[model samples]
Target chain A: MSGKSLDNRRVQKFHWMSRFLSGWAIFRQSFLGKIGLTLLALFALMALCSFIPPLVDPMYQPMAGVDPEISTVTGPSTRHWLGTDFMGRDLLSQLLAGARVAFMVGVSAAFMSVFLGTAIGMIAGYMGKFADTLLMRLADIIMVMPALVVLLMLAALFGQLSIWFIVFFIALFRWPGVSRVIRAQTLSLKHRPFIEAARVAGASHLRIIFRHITPNVLPLSFLYMTFQVTSAIIIEAALAFLGFGDPRTISWGMMLQWVWKTGHMFNAPYWLLPPGICISLITLSFYMLGRAMDEVLDPRLRKEGQTD
Target chain B: MGNGKQTILELDRIVKRYRTKGFFFGAHGQDVIALNEVFIKILRGEIFGLVGESGSGKTTAGRLIVRLEQPDQGKIYLDGRDITGLKGKASKDYSRRVQMIFQDPYQSLNPLLSVFDTISEPLIIHKIGNAEAREDSVWQAMKSVGLSPPHDFAHRYPHQLSGGQRQRVAIAHAMVLKPEFVVADEPTSMLDASMSAQIFNILLEMRRRLKVTFLFITHSLAAARYLCDRIAVMYKGNLMEIGPAEEVLRNPKHPYTQALMDALPKFVHSGGVKRYETLLQAEREVSGYVGCPFFVRCKVARAPKCSREKPPLKKLDDSHSVACFYAEPGIKTRSGGKA
Candidate 1:
């Protein structure tokens, strides 16, 4: 409370605020950050589109006949942006709808995977010995199982897999890799003074694991989640492409399946191209976002900021 | 607060043997004696130093006292209560009363936690106060350790701080609970010489201000001399000598104690003359013995007896004790030496 110390406080606060501002400025300056922001904005726009009904007229069908005339003059028009598919559905509308499905499966599955994986890993690493032995063995078993084969088996048993079911399957299988990552991080963190400090402070085992250890593993979990989301999207798309998806839903994968089944690639390339491009863009965006987060969350990456 | 309740901590005949797994399909494992029949008592408000070489079981003894590891055979009493095999809530309470400070400051702190959360977590867990009060206590604890402008430090992460700063944060975290006893296991070993002195000074100041007892473990004989009121010397899991710091350092009756004193750098010495060469020669001669733990290293050790029989701690004065067979009444060597 002395005048000198009070002045010192003001100086320290000023320094901290300056450092935070500079960090923010540097993040904005990075190309990866811009890409991440753009992808996130696209995802949000797609989510918003889900709430707003599609602009296409449900009854209107440009390809009324079996072999519709292929149009070459169509680039982007008021009637159909990005041209029309063989079925004459609005390509832009289908792309937007596909975005909604991709984002849903990508985000939900990733969130579930990270949450369950982090919790189980923290418990296994912190409690150690018996709990560690049991949980890691289970994780190893899950890790060795082929994800696609298991999903196919489940889909066959269920007759048809819905979007939610696909998300659940991906999330369940996605945890093993993340759990292993988290467990490794936790093994080192559990020995730290802060944990011992917590123990001496009379914190319970549950509190120690959740409050102390969980925060330490969060950056790793977050980075892993981003990668998991990309993987989940790929898995869902693979399932839909293999004709195991819900019949009523019109995901990009289902669009591909229908296009391939109808021989649209040989007759009408436009029909197959739109869905293929949409899937690639969506998956690529998630991969880029994961890479950006890897740079942001990793200490080694951030340390280079000083040199730069 | 009552008569016969002065002893805050006691370890009686404590032994810890670690069982190592056999190598490559071997039938049997090896038993390494980490602690062998060690006994010590810490009175209230006294700083007791346990000094020894590495693998001497000083660190193991500290861990056993806190029940971080269980002793193979022993009874540990705290405030007249036998807490040897206690677990769950009782063990937790004991831990709260007696905390530990580890050697590596960098490895000892969670890298992800901010300074505020790191120190306040314990307070929150113990339900010591409301959120506002906990914040106040965390700031207060930081301030006490000279982590001044506490608000600044509260939001900063561990990696942002220097070695001395991190150690200060660690001390604040340990002291925030207002524990009655602390087991500092080579707390300053990881610090530089200058920082080590500062840390020792802070510990001394805290000891005076809070009246907390300390079981300070270290391999540094000079540190033991500087900070401790009483010193116990150990060699290979044996408590070789225990007495007043001045008595032990000035007139060391045990050969191991004498060697440790003789080995100390002379510039830091307040009384002893230069005897570095003699100490080094003795150390070389004592490196081949299979008998007494120190028989291989003791220059003054008598043949047959010194190498054959392990010495028991014998009282030489009211406050001084030495563990050597020759430390008995009327026992004199050729030079009339009293070791």
Candidate 2:
């Protein structure tokens, strides 16, 4: 009994150690897929800024001044590098404070879009018939309308739309394209032998879809989610730049909007350029990362790479 | 014929029709009868071979037997139970009893999963054991299929395996559930000649070991002759003949079966004499048609009767049955065009 217990402990240790090693290897390999790694790092940093209080204290707000016209880069030497705006608030702190908001909107929108799109696509492809017809037609109708225009109109009417509301709107518009892709993939996968095997194995319809079908398509969904986040961030930035963002909360886009309105283009390029550069870099990184993930995750592409 | 064994599966007057439309607008839609009143009985522990060419509805019949596709009109009985429209738990139970092995081995196993996980999936779904026991069962299954050492194979992915190894994995996956009846639909078709033989041997071994009944569907008559005890010839969704494998292969009464036998490349003969004559004979016979399905390709086809009226299945001997109008007693020496 003692020997068996020791063996069990050894096996458990081996399993966990292997898992850690594999995870480390994956992390290492991700660095080779440079674009994805950079974006992932940025996203991680953004997440970190949200939970870490000192990283994003309200005292570091850059643009919190009584006279809005006065532009000065002056703050605490060690903590606030970008200095204070018109309100003598630290720019670094405000930027850090806004990280959580950006991540919340981006990730929430992506999750909603992916969930709804994948479910709809799987249902349409697997069940087919009238359900497919109706859903696809609805998707088409939604796709025809200009998404940005609708979002702008909605935001204007709502007047300082909540983060969740913005996420909902973004997701509602974003799902159509992903739905089509996922539907096509699901349609092909439905006819595969594994699905038939699942059927013959006495698996229920829901079980087959969730267990067999969903896992097969999950990597593709993940890749698409990354792309979705990049798009969501851009859209959120665009909305904020156009003055539809929450006035009370300062985001990267809000920073850009402030810079543009105050006509800082002549004197201080640094203030406007930092947020703009960050936005472009983050989006580009995500796109590159998504492409790399697509290549790696897809078995067909992986096989091709192996052969070559 | 008089053994009177209990039928484990039966397809009574099954019919499956598919509606097809043209690519262009306003093109007339037509109904293609994929299976027209097809009937067959599979006895318990019997390896019943369903042999046919492409589009013969053999795969469709196999699908119907497993309830993967519901037949338009039919009653399917499993172990004297009416499973025609069984749903939910009843259907699931039926599925567990009767499993199906698909044609392509490559597509049969999920590409993403490891060998152990793939084999253990059914056990997991059926709640056969806890995690530890399920893993043990998976390893046992892998070892049984000659994928040893089991530990080595369990960790390896699908792409790492060869075609034959992949096929073995697929078979292991199917057999892991210990199903009573298995429908191996052209399981060896995609395999190489040597690999095909290996798979056939493995299947035979599995049958002996597990005592599992198999409905082996194949287009290859040679394969059917080797593995199947009884063979059923299918022509355009119709069961033309069914009998002992040796009897069907050696003395084929159906013209389609005879033609198929003749089409097999003889080892001794070369290009000129035997080959051309066989080809010419096949073409001449296949050109003329009547009511019988094989009439279009029968060397010994009669005039009006063969074309006008469909031949019902008639028992020729104790073990053999042929669906030919002229399958009468002591009528073997009929005047023919070519021997």
Candidate 1, TM-score vs. the true structure? 0.86
lDDT of 1 by residue, B103-130 (tens): 7778767775667777876777667877
Give the alpha carbon lDDT tens digit for every residue of A1-308 in model 1.
24434554565577557655755565566677668668778766975674443423542222221113444323445666556655555555656677778888889999999988998888788778999999999999999999999999988998987778888888899898898889998998887766766666677888878777886688789888878888888888888888997676667887777677766656656667877876777677777777766655554665454421
True contacts kept of 1: 0.49
CAPRI accuracy category, model 1 = acceptable
Local lDDT at B48 for model 1:
92
lDDT of 2 by residue, A190-240 (tens): 999988898888888888898789977776677789789888888888888
Fraction of the reference Cα-Cα interface contacts (below 8 Å) that each candidate reproduces: 0.49, 0.60
Provide the fnat value for model 2, as a fraction from 0 to 1. 0.60
TM-score of every prediction relative to native: 0.86, 0.86
Give candidate 1's error at residue A7 in angstroms: 17
Q: How many clashes does the backbone of model 1 have?
A: 3
Query: What's the lDDT for residue B303 in model 1?
Result: 72
Off by over 4 Å in 2: A1-36, A39-59, A63-100, A263-267, A298-308, B22-28, B129-140, B269-290, B328-339
Q: What is the TM-score of chain A in candidate 2?
A: 0.81
Per-residue lDDT of candidate 2, residues B73-147 (tens digit): 978778878787998888877776888888898898887676766887888778887777777777777877788
Candidate 2: RMSD over Cα atoms?
4.5
